[model samples]
Target: MKYVEKAPHVDPVRMRHITDEALLAELGVTSIAEARPWRRPDPAWDGPATIEEADALIGAEVDFLDKGRGRSRLYGFHYLRWMTPLVHAYRETGDARYAAEWDRLFRQWYGTRDQVEGDWPGLDVIWYSLGVWARSMHVTRAMAELADEPALSDECWAMMMKTVLGGARWSAEEHDEFRHGNWQFVCAAELLHVATLFPELPEAPRWAEIGRARVLEHLELDVRADGGHHERSPGYHGMVLDAVHRVLALDPSFAEHPRVRAMHSWFASLVTSGGWIPHLQDSGVVWPAGALRRGAELGVRPEPGSHLLDASGYAIFRAGHLHTVINYGPYVGHELEPHSHHAALDFVLSGWGVPLAWEAGGPPSYDDPGYYDWYQATRGHNTILVPGEEYTEDRKAGLDLFHAGQHVDVFAGHHHGYSARHDRRIVFVRDEPSYWLVTDSIDADAVWQVHGLAPWKPHGSGYVTKNLLVVPLEAPDEVLHGNGPARIPDPATGTAEYGEIHSLGLRRADGRFTVALVPFTDDPPAVHLATVPPLASPQETSVPDHLRVAIGGIVDTVSASTWARADVREGWAADG
Candidate 1:
C-alpha cells in the first residue's frame, strides 16, 4: 500500500465492486475477454486502492454503452489517458498494487479492445489512426515510466514495443492519410515522444525529423493567424496547445516561434477576470487552470490586454474589473466552423464579481436535449433572429468600424447572415456607472433575446444578476418577457442552472430593441429610456441610442444614427 490519493470517496454503487472476482460475477463474464467493451475504460477513473477494487467498478458501468461505443475512437483515446496516472502513482510510491493494476488493465484493454463489431470500414473505428496512434504513445510512455521496475510482464513489454515501433514507422513513412487539427498535432506529439523518450530505437532520428516537419507545417495551417485554434473552440484550442507543449517538453527551442507565442498570448487574453473563457463555440465557462499554468511554465508569456483578433472576429474588451467578449462569425471555413455558435454578434460579460450577461449553453456532450435547438440555434443567442429565414451561417462577417477611446470604446460589426444584412454595435463606457450599450440593426422583422446569469430577478425595470442589469431601453419597467431559466455555461460541470434567461422578444412591428448592460456593486442605478432624435438607420425604429442613463447624479446619452454616424455620446453631465 504505497500509493493512495486523498479523494477516496467514490459512488456507493462503484464502491461495491471491490474485487475482480466480484466484477466477473456482477457482469456475468467469467473472463475479462467476455467483458470486452462492457468493461470499457473511464478516463475519469480515480486510481483504485487496489486493482481488485477497480475491476468490479469498471464492470458496474457501461452495460448499455458497449454496443453504442463500438467504433468510438474518442472512447479509446480516453481509456489510454486514464492509464498514465496509474503509472505515475506506481512511480511515486513504488506500490506493487498500483503497478499490478496498471499492468492488468493494460493487458485487459489490449487483449479485448478492437475486436471487430459489425463494421464495414477501412479500420476498426475503435482503434483507427487516432486510437492506434494514442495507444502507441501511451505504450511508449508507460515503458518509460516503468523503466525502474518489472511493472510490465515480458510478454506485455514485447507487445507494446511492437506497437511503438509500428506507430513510429507509420509516422515516418508516407502512408499519407490526411490528418489536421488536434489529430495531426497529436501524431506530431507522439512522434516526438517516440523520438526523444526512446532515442535508442533505430528509427528514432527519422521520427524526430518527421515530427518536427509536421509540427511546423500544421502549426501554421491549423492555428489561426490571430492565435486561436482554427476550429473556434477554446477546448480544442487547449488541445492543440497541449500538443505544442508536448513538443516543447522534448525540444525547448520551439517556444521561440511567433505562432506559439501568439497562441499563448491569445489564450491568456481570452481568459476572463474569473479565469473562465467567454468562448463562442463548443466551450464552457470552466477555468483552464492547468493549461494556462502550463502555457506560463513553457516560458511563452501572454501579452496581457484587450485584443481585437480581427482575423477570427473575436473582440475582447476589458475595463477595470469588467471583461466582455463579442463574437462575430468568420471563425473558420464553413466545415471547420461547425462547432461555432450561430450567434454572431453575441457577447458575454463578467463584472461586479459575477457573470452579468452570458451566452446560450454549450460544450454539450451531445446528451443535452437543447443542444441543437437552443444552444447552437440562432435564436439561442443574443443576436436578432429574422422572421422568415435562418441566418446564412456561411456568409462572411467583418468588423466594419472600431474605436477604443479614453472613456468609451465602440466595436461595430456586420454580417450578411440575413438577406438584408445584420449589423451590431457595442459601446462600452469605461467610466462610472459602467455599462455596455448593444444595438442590433436589421432591415426586416427581427426577434432578439437576452440572458443574465442565474438566480436573477426582476428589479425596478431590468433583470439583475446580483446587482448588474440587462434591461431593454424600449420599456424601462419591463424586463422583456420576464425572466426564465435557460442553459448557461457551468464552470464546474459545463452545463448548469446558473443562467437566468430573461428572453425579451421585440419584433420589428413592435420596434427593434436596444439593451443596456449595466454592471454595478452595492446598489444598482435606475436605468431609463430617454427621448432623442431618431437616426436614419435600420434600428431607427428602436431607440437604443436614446437611453438617458442616470447614475451617480449624472446623465449619459445612448442613441444611434442610420445614414450618418450618430453622435453616440459617452459623457456624463451633472444631474442639475
Candidate 2:
C-alpha cells in the first residue's frame, strides 16, 4: 500500500455496520427512509443531523471553557462520531445533498476553530484544542469520498495542509516529556496518520518519521517490564492500548514488536472471569473485550491459565471457570501525578462471568467531593484501612512467594501504607472445590488502630466481630470524606459512581487473619467464619513512643494473636 494515499485500516464491512448503527442513533430513525429528516439541501443545517425530538442537538461554540478538561461545549462536534454517517450516506447513496451538508459542516467548524484558538488561556489549554483539532482533521481527511465537488475538495485539501504543518511544528517543538505517555501517544498517532495519508505534502516524510519514532519510544516506556502501563491506572492502560492498536492497524509492521505483544498479553490476562478488569489505580469498571479480541488477532495471547506480572506486581489465579486477581506491588510513580491508589496487596475475586467482589466502581466526576473521599481512598478498595490515616504513594513492597505450578498458586508481599507494615500472603489451591486463602499481617505500634476493609456490593452478607466492623457501605453524605491539601485538575468525569456497599472491617494491629474465598458462577456462596488457634507465637514486635502516646493507654502486654478463617461454600461439585 502507498503510504501517502493510505487511509485508516478500517474494514469496509465492519465500518458499514458500525456506520449504519451510528446513523440510526444520531437521526433517531428506524429505517433508511427516515434517515434524512432535514431538507436535502438545508444550507443552515451545517452541522451533523440531530434527532428531531432532541432539543439540544449540538452546541454552537467550539471552545466553551466551562465543560472542563478535554470536553468541549460542542461534544458531538468534537467527537464527530456523526462523520461515519455523513460520509457513508454521501458515498453509498450518491447523494449530492449529503455532500453539500458535509461542506457546510466543514466550513462552520473551520470558522469556529480559528476563533477558539485566539481565545485559549495558555499552553495547558492548548492540549484540549490540540486534541479537538487532531480528531476533526483526522475525520475530514480520512473521508476522501465525501468531498465530491471541486470547490469542497480544494478547501478540504487546504485545511489538510494547514493541519499537517501546524501539527508537525507542534510535534517538533514540544519536548517528549512535556506531553508524555498518553499525550505523546495521541499527538504522535495523529501526526503519523496525517503524514501517511498525505505524503505528497512537503513536510509529510519528516513528520511521519518523527511521529513513528516518538510513538515507538513511548510505547516501550509507558508499558512497564510487567506489561502494565506506568500510569498504574488500568483505565488509562486500556485507553493507551487502544490508541496503540489504531497505530498498529495503520502500519502492521509494529504488530510483531515484543513490547507491543506484551502489552496485549497483559490486557488479555488482566480481565477477571466476570468480564471485568481489575479496577487498579484510576482504571474504570468497564471491560475492553474488543481490545482483547484485537490483541488475540495480533498474536498477543493470554497465559495458558494463570500467571503473574512480577514487575507490575499483579498475580492472576484461574481454576476451572473461576478467576481471581491479587495486587502486591510497589507504587508506580510517574513524572506527573501517577494516579496510584493506596490499595496495595489488595485482591478481587470473580467466577465465570460474575464479579464476586469488585474494586470500588469508577470515579464518576473529578469535581465531586466523593472522588477523593471514597472512590480514590483506601476504604474504596478490598484491602486494609487505617482508621484515621490515609495511604500515600510510597513504593514499599516486596514479593515473598510466586509459584503457579503443581495445582497451587502462592503469592505474598508487604506494603507500607498508613505508616504501617503490611505483610499479605495468598494461596490458591486448585483441588476439588477450588478455593483461595488470604492472609494479612498488619504490624503497627499500639499508637495506630488498623481496620481490614473487605468491600463488596451491598447485596452481599457478612458478620461483624469485636475485631471487625461489618456494615453496609454508606455514601459520602453518611461517611466522613477527607481530601489532601494539594489539589490537581482532573479532566473528565470517570465512569465510577458511588453506591451503598457491604464493608467487612477488622480493627486489630499486629495481627494475622485468614479468609477463604470461593467464587460461584451464579448465586452468592455461603460463608462460615471460624477461629483458628495460633500454631506458634506471633512474630517479634515493639511499640514506638508515638504509638504509645497516640493510644493514650497501656499497650496490651499479651501481644495476642487472633486468626479468623471464613470458609466459602460454592456448588463446585465436579471439582470437589
Candidate 3:
C-alpha cells in the first residue's frame, strides 16, 4: 500500500518495526482503514477570503503556479502552498474540481523529475536548500495532510511516498538558518510532521529525535530571553509560532514546556484591544494567525496589562480603546540582517475604532522597487528622519527608559542615524484615554513624519486621519515635498498585509517640536501651545525650557527636557 527506502545515515540500532496500530493511534485513529480524525490541512492558516481564493484556484483563468506577485522570484507558488487551498476547499465543500486540480498539478510536477541527487536534484533546479525545503513540505502535505487521500494514479501515490522518504533523508542534512532566521521553525515542523505521519520508516524515529532537538535548541537560541523572535518581525514571530503549533498539535509532547509557554505569551503581549497585532519590523497591521488564536485556547499567556519588555525594548500599552506598541534597541541580528526596518521610536497607534498610524511597506516581494528606497528607509516610518540617512545598516535606535502606568505612561528613545542625535519621548495620558504628548529633540535639521492610515490632507492647522488629529505644537508652515508616498503590501492571499498607508512629513529647521495626538469625531477639538522660552540665560546654555499644551480643553505644563508635566517629572532619557 505504501513504499519507502531506508536512508543510509539512520542508525540501524535505533530502528524499530513500529506497528500499524500505534502509528494510527498517534493520529487518534484505531486503524489505517478509518480516516484520520486529527490531521488538519494547515494549522494557524488565516486568509480573509480563503474559500473564495481557493475556489478561484480551480478556475482555468487563475494559474496556481504563477510565481511571485509580479517579480517572478518567489518559489512559494511553484509547488508549495498550492496544495493548502485545494485541500482546504475540498474539505469545505467536497468539491471534485479541487481534487481534479490537485491531480493535474501533481502529475505536472512529478513529470519534471527524472532522477535524484542528494534526494532532490531535479526538484530544486531553481535553488538548492530552499527548493528542497519547499518540496519537502509540499510532498508531505500531499501525502500526509490529506488523509482522505486525493484520488491519484497508484503510480503517483507510490512515487510520493518515495519522495517523502528521500526528502526526510536529504533535509536531515542541509543548509539550515536556525541561528539567523525563521527557517529552523519551518524545518522542525516539516521533520516532525514527517516522523508522526510515517513512523514505520527506519528514519522516522531519528527524524523525530532530530526535530525535537531542533525545537528545543530553537527555544533557547532563536527566541530571545524577552520572548521575542530574534528576527524582529511580529508577522514572522506568528509564523514561527504557527509552525511550532501545527507540528506539536499532532504529537502533544512539548506544548507545556516553559519556553514554549513563554513564546506564546510574548506574541499575546502584542495583541491590541482591537484583536490585531501592530506592525513591527517588516510586518504589517495584521490579525493574529489561527495558531495564535489556538494557543489562547491552551491558556499560555501571562497576566494582562500595559508593560515593558526591557530586553527587546518593546513597550506595549493596551487599554479598552487605546493601543500602542513601540520598539527600540540594539539591532537584533546585524550579521545577516533579518527582514527589518530602520524605524526607531516609530509606533503603531489605534484608538476609538480606527487605526491611527501603522508600519509601512509590509513584506513586499523582496525585489520590489521601493523595498529599500522607501519601505526600509528611516523616513518611511512615523519618526523623525534626518536627510542623509538612507536605509543603511547603521540606522539604529535604543530605548533609554520606560515607565508603565494605568492612567499615564512614558517612553524615551534615541538614535543617531545621520551623525546627529535625535531624542524622542512620548507621554501617554489616559485621563481621556486617547491622547499623546510627543516631544522630539534633535541637534540637526530633520523631516518628522507620520505614517497615517489615510493620506494626509491639509486640515486647518495640522494633519488628520479618519479619526485622529496630529497637532504639532511647534508648527511648520508647510509639509515638504520630499516625503509622502503610499506603501504597498505583499499580495499574498492569506496575509492581511495592512494597506496603502501614506507617509506624511514636515520639515523642521531646528528639529525641536512637541506634538499632540488626539482622537475625536464630529466637531474639531481646540488645541493650544504656549512656549515658555528659557529666561534667555546667557550663562547657562542648557537651561530647561517649559511649555503649556492644551488639547480638546485638557491642558498641562510640559517640560522640554523632561518630556512630561513639570510636576510629574521623575525620569528623563538623559538619566542614563
Candidate 4:
C-alpha cells in the first residue's frame, strides 16, 4: 500500500484540544488488557454479555433505534468509537498493551463477513462508523510507528478503507448535505479529515471538493449573518461551532473564512459572564468550559449589538441590572429539525447575573412520547398559554413592532399558538430602577381561556395579585436558584441547590390581560407598578404603556395598599 503524505498543517495536538472528552470518558478503561472486555454493559448487547463473552455477536438482531433498546446499543457504538482515546493513551504511555488491544478490537469488530457486512441499521450507526473511521485515520496518519507495524498496519489500512467507502456511499445516498443541518456537518467534516489524511486514494479529490462544499453550504444556511444559528438553540449553535473548528484544524484555508469567524463570534456572544448560555431547546444551561477555552484560543470575538439575533429570532436586552432574552424568531422546528420549543415571542428575565423568570423544563428525551405533545407545547414556556391549544411550528411568529431608545425598550409580536391571533407587547422603562409591563391581546370569534405565567423563584415576601406578581430579590442566591430549562444545580440527585424553578401565574377569560412585574430590595429606589387607564383621546405624551414609579414621593395613586387582588390567587409562588 502506498503511504499518503499528511497535510503539513494537520497536527494532532490541535485536534486533541477540540476532541469530545465527555464522550471519550463514557468508555474509559482502567487497563489496556481490559479494552476488549470493556464493551458497554447495555442489555441491548444481545441480552447482555459477561466479560468472558465480550466479543460475542450480541447485537446482530437488535434494532438500535428502538427507544427501549436504543441507549444500550448506543453505548455499544460508543465502545466502537473508542479508537480515539485508545490511540491517545497509547501515544502518551508508550505501552504495547494499547496497540495489542486496538488490533484485537479492530479484528473483533471488522474481521469477518458477518461482522463487517451486516446491516448498518440506522443513520446513527453510520454516523458512529464515520467517527470511528476519522479517529482511526488520525491515529494511523499521525503515528507512523503505528502505521509501520507490518501486519497490524495492513489490517488498519483495510479497515480504514472499508469504513470510509461505506460511510461516503451512505452519506451520498441517505443525506442531502445542503438540507440536513447538524448531521451533514459531522459527515462532511469527517470526509474532509479523511481526504486530508490520504491524498493517494482514487476518491480523495472528490471527497475534498464535496466535503468542502457541503460544510460551507451548512455555514451559509444554518448560521445567520447576525452570528446566530437558525435553529435558535444555544446548545446546537455550540455543537456546530465545535465541528467547524475541528475541520479547520485539518484545512487551514477555512480558518479565516468570514462565515467560520462569524459562527465562533456568535458562540462567544451567547455566553454569559457566569459562563452559561440560557438553555434553549436541547441546549444545556452551562456551555462546556473546554469548548469555551478553545473558542477563546481561536480568537472568536463576541460581536456587539443590542443583543439582537434578528435572523435567528431572539434578543437579549440589557439595562442597569437586567438581562432579558425575548424569543421573536421564526418557527425553529421543521420537518428535519424539531429540537426547538414552541416558545416564540416568549421572554426570559435575569437580574444582576441571576435568572428571575424562565421555563420549568420539558420532557428529558426527544424519543419520549410526551416530547411533542407536552414539553414542546405552549404551556411549557414562560408565555401566555391558551387552554386546550398547542403551538405548532407551521405558523411563524413575526415581530410587528420594535423600538430601542434611550428611554424605553419595547417589542411586540404575534404568534398563532392558538386559534386566535395572540398579539403580545412588552415594554421596559429606564426609570431609576426598571420593571416590565406586558400586555397580551387576543382576537377571535369565540371566548378563550387565557393566562400568563411568570415562573420565578420565591426569593422573598411575594404574592400573586390579580394582574401582578411580585418577587423581592433580597439576595443573589434566590436569583441563582431560578435558572431553568436546564437545571442549574441539577434536579435528579437533589445534591445541587440551583435547579429548582417555581411558577407565578395569572388567569383571566377576557380578551386582554395586562400584567406587571414589580421588584423589591432592602435599599431605596424600590420598583413599583400601576395600570394606566385607557386615555379618552390620543395625545403626544411619552407616558409608558403602564407605570413604573420609584417609591419615594409623589401622589402614589397606584399604591400596594390599593391593589385589587387583596385576596391572593391560588398556587401563588409566595404562598407555596
Candidate 5:
C-alpha cells in the first residue's frame, strides 16, 4: 500500500487545459449546445449512412424506454444512447422540443434514484457509470444550456458530483489492503477524473491525492512486470487495463510511468484468434465489448508481427511481449463486492483470436436450481477437482495460491469434502509457441481413492476420457480402456528418467471412494489424484450417469480397479 505522495511534478491545470482544448477542437464545438450533436449519434447501420439513419437509431432507443420494459433501475447508462441523440438534435437544429426531451429524461433518471438507495456497488460499475455521466456533464456544459431553469442544472450537477465523488470516497474507505489491489487502481481512476474536472470543489484535491497514492500502490503490487492482472480472467484483465488507461489519459504524468506503458502493452497481448480471449472462469458471462471499443478509441493497436490474440496468455507489441494471464492474488476485495462470482483456479486459453478452450460460463437465470451447481463445480471450469465434492454447496471457494510469468499457475482453494484427507493442484505452463497444463493432487493419507469425473455427458455415449496418465490408453471394452505398463512419475521431480510409480488404491470418503493416479513420466512428478465412487445404479438415474475412466490415453471402461502409468514426459501431465 506504499505510494509516492509528493505533489506531482506536472501541473494539473495545464493537463486539463490541453485535454479540453484538444477535445473541443477535435469535435468542432464552441458552446455546450454545439457540443450536444457530437456527443450522441445513431449507430452506423451501414458504412457512413445519412444523419437520418442516425436519427432513426436514436428514435429506436428512445422508443425502448417508452415501452416501460427496459432495465428497471436508474442505472445511469440505460439513458445514454437515447440522451446522446436528444442532445445532438437540440444543439444542431436549435429545436426547443429536442432540448426539453433531453432535459426531461435526464432529470427523470437523475431525480428518481435507486429505490433501495445507497452508493453504487462494484468498482467497475461505478467507473462505467461515471464515464457516462461525465460525457453528459461535458456536453451540457455544467448545465449552462439549461439557463432558463438553473435549478434543474444545479440539481443535476449536485446529484452527479455527489454520486461520482461519493463513489470514490467509498472505494477509498472499503478497500482491503491485502486483496482487491486492482480495484485500488480502478476506483482511483474514476475519483481522479472527478477531481480533474471539478477542481473548485474543496475536497477535490484530497480525493485526488488519495487516488494518486492508490494508483502508485497498485502499480507496485498488483501489476506484474509482464502486465498481467493478478486474477486470471481475460475479461477482468481487459477491464483493469481499460481502467488504467482512463487514469493515464486524465493525467499525462501517469502515462510516463513504467506501469502505465507496461499495462498498455500487456492488454494488447490477450487478444486471441477471432478477437476472442481465452474465456477462462466466470469471464464467459460477458464478451469483451467495452475493452475492444475503448482500445480502438485510444488508437492502441496490436503488434504487427503477432496475432491479435495469442494462445499463450501473452500479447506481442512493438515494445515487447506483455503477459495476458490473470493473477488471482488481489481477489480478496470481491468478497464484499456484488460482481464477484465463485470461480477459482479456472483459466481461459485463447490463440489466433479463437477461444481454444473455456470454462462454461454462468447461466442467465440466477434463480435456476442449478445455479450454484453450475457456478461452483469442477466441470464449470477446465481445472482439476478432487473426488467426493471439494466445493462448498454454496459454490464459494478460497484462492490458495497463484504465481505469474511466461506461464501462470494456480492452486486449489477449498476442499468440498476432502479438507482433512487430500489437497488438489492445477498448473498451466506455456513454452512460448506451445502450451501444456499439469494437474496434481496430494493426499495426507497414503491410501486413498482418486476419481476423475466430468459433469457434462460426453457426446453420443456414456463414456468419458479421464486422461490421468501420460500414455494413451487402449479401448478394451465398451465402457473401459486400459494401457501403460509404462512408468508414471511425479511432477515436482525434475528428472526426465527414472519414472516414479505409485500403486493405484481406492478408499471411500463421504459417499465416494478415492482413486490414485501415478505419474507416467520419468522422474515422475508427485501424483495428483481425485476420488470417484462407483457409478450409481441406473435406477437412481435421475442424475444421468455418464462417468467413464481410462488408463493412459484411451477410453476403456466404465469402472476399472487397475490401470498403468506411462513414461511420456513431453505432452500433457496429470496428478493423482
Candidate 6:
C-alpha cells in the first residue's frame, strides 16, 4: 500500500520523446506531433451564449440526477459522459463562471468524501470520477489558455491522483459483488496514467508501476485472440480498451505489446453494418467516439464489407480517411461478478454520428426496476431465449473464459429463473471476416415448449407489424400460440401460421420437431427456441446458424447433443 515518496519529476525531454514514440507507433506514422484531420469540422453553434446556457444544461442534468430517476445520475460512469461536454464547452468558451459552477458540482458530489464509502455509491462514483478527470486532462491545456488559474489546475491534478490510486485499492477483490472486471482494470490503468503524468507527486511512481502490471496481467487473461473481450459485451470491451489505450499512450513500455494492438483490432472486427457494435452478452448504449479515436490512433481498420455497417459506419484500419468508433465490451472484470446481467452476446451498432440498433440506455442508479430488471433480463438483448423462463442460474451472470484463439461463454445458473433445470448454451465464434453464433438446448423430459421470433420486440407493434415467425409445439396436452390470427393451420405441413410469417414454421410435423424462422426485414427478428426435456443432457450440444434457438430441458434430466455439419441449412435439418 506504500507509495513512492519524493520521486523525481519526469523530464520534459523524456516525456516528449516517449509520447512521440508511442503516438508514432500507434498511428503508424513517421512523426508523433502531426495532427490528423478531423473526421468532421465542428458544427457551428449560434452566437456565443453566456453562463446561462451552461447553467441550463447543468440544471437539466441535476433534474435528471436522482438515484437512477433520470439518465444523468444512474452511476458515476454515466455522470462522466454527461460531464465531458460541459467541461469541454466551458473550456472552449473561456467562461470562468461555468468553470466555477463545475468546481461547485464536483465539490457537492465528493466534498464531504463521506459518500465515497461503499461499492454502490463510493466506488461507482470514483470509477467514473476517474474518467471525468482523465477527459478533463484533454481540455486542461485549453483551460490554461483561457485562464491564469494555476491553482485550479494543480488542485485538480492532485485530487485526481488521490482519487484514482485510492480506487485501485478496492480492485483486489475477485468477486462481482465488489467490482466489475473491466471497470476495475480501467480504473487501474487510468490511475497509472495519472500517476505517470505527475511522477514527483506522492506515491505516483509506485502506484503507477503496480497499476500498470495489474492491468497488463488482466488484459492477457481477459482479451481474446479474436479481439473480443472475454466478458462478451462489445460496449464494455471498448471502454476497457479506451482506458488501456490511454495508459499505453502515456507510457511507452506498453507500445510493443502484441496484446495491446490485438485488443484494438478485436474491437474493430465486432462493429456491425449500422455502425453499431454487436449487442453480445449484456451490452448497452454507447457512443462511437472513443472507438473511432482508438482506431485512428492504432492504425487498425475493418476489412471492406467485412463488417455489418457501411464504410462510414465502420472504422477504417489503415487510412485516416474515415472516422472510426470501437465498442468496449459490457461489464467490468471481476471474479464471480454480480453486476453480470443476462445481457450475454449483445452489441451496439452506430453510423455517422448516430447509433444503429443501440442497446437500450440505462441510468447509473440501481434504484429503478427498469434499470436493474433490464440489466438482468435476456429480453433486452439480441439473443435466444427459452419459452417460459429467463437465463440459467449457476453461470448465468459470470464470465466463462476469454483467451487463446477462441472466445466461449455460457448464461446458465439463476438469471434464467430455473433453480433446478439447466439446458442452454450461447456460443459466439470469430474466425475473422466471418462471425458465427450457435445456441443449443436439449429437452428430455418434454415438460416445456420451444419457440422463436426474428426481430426482438418487447412491445406489441414489433410483433404484429414486423416480419416475424412463430413456431409452436403441440404435444398431446400442450397448446400453441402465434402472434396474429388465432391459429391458422398450415394445410400442407399441418403447422399453424396465425400471422404473416415470412418463412416456414415447424409444428408437430413428425414425432420430432424443428422450425426455421427467417425475417424479411433488414435484420432478423430476435428469436427464442425452447424445448421441454424429460431429463437434462449428459453432455453439451451445438447448433450452427445466425438465428437464435433455445431448449427447455426437464428438471435435472436434460442434456445437449453435438453434431458436425458443413452448412447451416443442412445442420438444422440433419438428424442427431
Question: Which one is best on TM-score?
Answer: 3
Q: Candidate 2 — what's its lDDT?
A: 0.51
TM-score of each: 0.77, 0.68, 0.82, 0.67, 0.49, 0.54
Give the Cα error of residue 404 in candidate 6, in Å.
20
Full candidate order by TM-score, most accurate first: 3, 1, 2, 4, 6, 5
Candidates in order have lDDT scores of 0.60, 0.51, 0.62, 0.50, 0.37, 0.38
lDDT of 5 by residue, 117-186 (tens): 2234542322343343334333333233443432334344333334444454454555424344344456
Off by over 4 Å in 5: 1-99, 114-184, 222-226, 230-232, 284-335, 338-352, 362-371, 385-388, 392-576
The candidate scoring highest on lDDT is 3
Pick out the ten consecutive residues of candidate 4 with the lowest summed lDDT: 29-38
Give the per-residue lDDT digits (tens) of candidate 2, residues 1-576.
121122222222111112255433432323322111111221112234433312222233334323443322233244444444555555546756555555555556554553343222443323342453345344543345543343344355334334444555566446334345565666676667656654544556776787788778777776788677766667777766765765775688988778788887787777765455756776666466676777778777677677888777788888776677787776665443456666677776665554455556445444446666666677767776666675777847777666675545667677777676877666665654455555566654212112222333322333322223222211111222222211111113312233344444444444545545544434444444232232343353221111100001211111111111224211211100
In candidate 2, stretches whose alpha carbon ends up further than 4 angstroms from where it belongs are 1-123, 128-142, 149-161, 175-180, 334-336, 445-501, 509-511, 521-576
- Candidate 4's TM-score reads 0.67
- Least well predicted 10-residue stretch by lDDT in candidate 1: 1-10
What are the clashing pairs of model 4?
Answer: 313-329
Residues 133-183 of candidate 1 have per-residue lDDT tens digits of 567655655665564455556445434544565566666663233345666
Question: In model 5, what lDDT does residue 460 have?
Answer: 21
- Model 2: how far is 324 from its true place, Å? 1.5
> What is the RMSD, in Å, between candidate 5 and the native fold over all Cα?
14.4
Native-to-model Cα distance after best TM-score fit, residue 136 in candidate 6, in Å: 7.8
User: Residue 368: error of model 1 in Å?
Assistant: 4.5
Ranking by lDDT: 3, 1, 2, 4, 6, 5
